[model samples]
Target: MTYSGVVKVGGPADVHELTDLMISKVAVGPMHNNAYLLRCRATDEQLLIDAASEPRTLLNLIGESGVASVVTTHQHADHWGALAEIVDATGARTYAGRLDAEGIPVPTDVLVDDGDTITVGRVELTARHLVGHTPGSIALVYDDPHGHPHVFTGDCLFPGGVGNTHDDPEAFARLIDDVETKLFAQLPDETWVYPGHGNDTSLGAERPQLPEWRRRGW
Candidate 1:
């Protein structure tokens, strides 16, 4: 039985595989925020990223997978709309960057900092705090043993450019610097970026436009 590639629009989880991991994206709510389900193939242990909206849909997608934790990419309301409900239903521990933990409506079980390691099943994800999109915005990096690395960048990065920085010069500079140095400088070009909203892109695809995004000041 082969797995289909269709990402069910406005409904169930859209499943995809990356080496030993399984990733599912479920688009929810008026904002169409993406809620990702990450599973480790060897142990079947799962972790969800951003329980954005529509608790029922999110819960349905998590069926029988045995979720270990839910990590919110940032404190933005759109990112954790269903967080409380999902946590209550699954009893899974919650994690978020320490700087933004207080802004969230629910209590954070683990306040992660930059360089901290989060063990999911047999693999590990490293936390990189990318400021300016929000004070505590984070990107989770999972390096596959056989293939290119994968990153969940939340709202700090996207296909065309860096995340929205609200037109503030300082904020823009901070975000651009962190993105350029911490992300693009360190990670390989083939690293897959799964953002908080919309479609996915690779660091290789967005690397060249770094100068343009900085110049445009968006």
Candidate 2:
């Protein structure tokens, strides 16, 4: 199969192939949260992002590749609902933002602070601490040497705007500011954004809407 070609399970809408770094995408649960299975082609080692929901399904998808670690993007239950089960089944280490570690149901083996490096086989993912949607919301940055950078943004960012701040002005400001300087300002337009609960987007697409998003305050 080609790198960009998708493998349909039940349907292409449920699962797909990223075609880079052998990343696999799964959209599961009632909320349709996205979970990614990242495989390091160099070593065949794997890492899971979000764990999201559907323990049985996730475990089945993981199969025997063996996950090196499960990175919880944030403390939200929807994101980590099956985290404990996956960890128990695979013995994969757990990682989370230090500030949100206590809130995660499973014990986080590694406290990922901003700029901290998390390894998956030969690949290294840098943690970008983005506070707002939650006090310790984080986005993982994976700069693939073969292509453009890929950022796994939990709920802190999305295609059109920033995550919901519950109408809190301060939280909104903080999230937007950090996103701009830390993510948007630093990464190039080709950077891919793998968000928490929906389809993927690009920094180039989102960059132009920063002003509009700020004005709307969503």
Candidate 3:
């Protein structure tokens, strides 16, 4: 089946295949958090993003290959609901943003920073730290060699706008600025966005609304 990037809490995951990677996206937990299982085609090594919830389902998705690493996009509870359990089960190395590492209950094996490279087999994902939603919200960028770029934006970005800032103007400003400079400006229009919750979108689809989002201050 074609990859739609649409998933529900209890539905089956949507898998996207690329030349060197296979991205399986599933929605889990009450919050409808999206967890991504990335498998490297070359080495068969795997990595998971967000381990958000439902350890059993995640483990099943992981299968016998297991995962080499689990990256928490941010320190939010809903985002890492199953982090400890998943980590315990797979013995996967835990990675979190340097600033939000302390907020996560599990000890982080790797503290990622902006521009840091994380590898799964032969595939490399670049971390882009976007501050605002959380002091250390990181977005993982995978630039596909054969196609467009793919971004896993925890809660910092979404389809319509950036993540909520609890009405804090300063926080919203920082988030919008970081998203524009670090993401929109840097990436191409075809960049596919995989958010923490809800459906996926592209930078091109959202580029036109940047000014409106800033003006609305969300």
Candidate 4:
């Protein structure tokens, strides 16, 4: 089937195959958190993003080819509900943003900052540290050589607007600024965005709404 990037809890994952990489996206847990299992076609090595919840389902999705690394996008409880469990089961190296590493219960093996590289075999994903959403929320960028860029935005971004700042103007401003400068300004409109929860969207689909989102103060 074609990769639509639409996944639901208790449903099958949506797989997107690139030239040298395979991305499988699934929704797990009560919050319907999205977890991505990335496998390198060349070396067969795998990396998982956001072990949110439902360890059993995640383990089942992993199958025999265990993951080599697990990256928690942020320190939010909903994002790492299955981090320690998945880590213990697969013995995968843990990675988190340096500023939010302390908040995650599982000891982060690698504390990442902006511009850090995480490899899945031959594929390299660049980390973009987006502050405001939990201080250390990060978005992973995979610039496909053959195609367009793909970004995994935890809770920092979604289709309509940036993540909730709980009416805090400063936090919202910081998030929008980082998202605009680091993501929107740097990447092209074709960039695919995989969020922490719910369905996916593209930069082009959201670009026109920047002014509206800012004005609404959400």
Error of 2 at 122 (Å): 0.3
Q: Using Cα atoms with residue i matched to residue i, what is each candidate's TM-score against the true structure?
A: 0.95, 0.92, 0.99, 0.99
lDDT of 2 by residue, 40-126 (tens): 777888999998888887887788777889999999899999998899899999999999999998999999899999988878889
Writing each residue's lDDT as its tens digit, candidate 1 over 101-135 gives 99999999999999898877998999999999999
lDDT of 3: 0.95
Q: Extract clashing residue pairs from model 3.
A: none
Q: Each candidate's root-mean-square deviation in Å? A: 1.9, 2.6, 0.6, 0.6
Cα distance off (Å), candidate 2, residue 115? 0.5
Candidate 2 TM-score versus the reference:
0.92
Residue-wise lDDT of candidate 3 within 18-118, one digit each (tens)?
99999999999889999999999999999999988899989999999899999999999998889899999889999999999999999999999999999
Q: How does each model score on lDDT?
A: 0.88, 0.85, 0.95, 0.95
Model 2: CA > 4 A from native: 1-20
TM-score of 3: 0.99
Clashing pairs in 1: none
Report the CA-based lDDT of candidate 1 relative to the real structure.
0.88
The better-scoring model by lDDT among 2 and 4 is 4
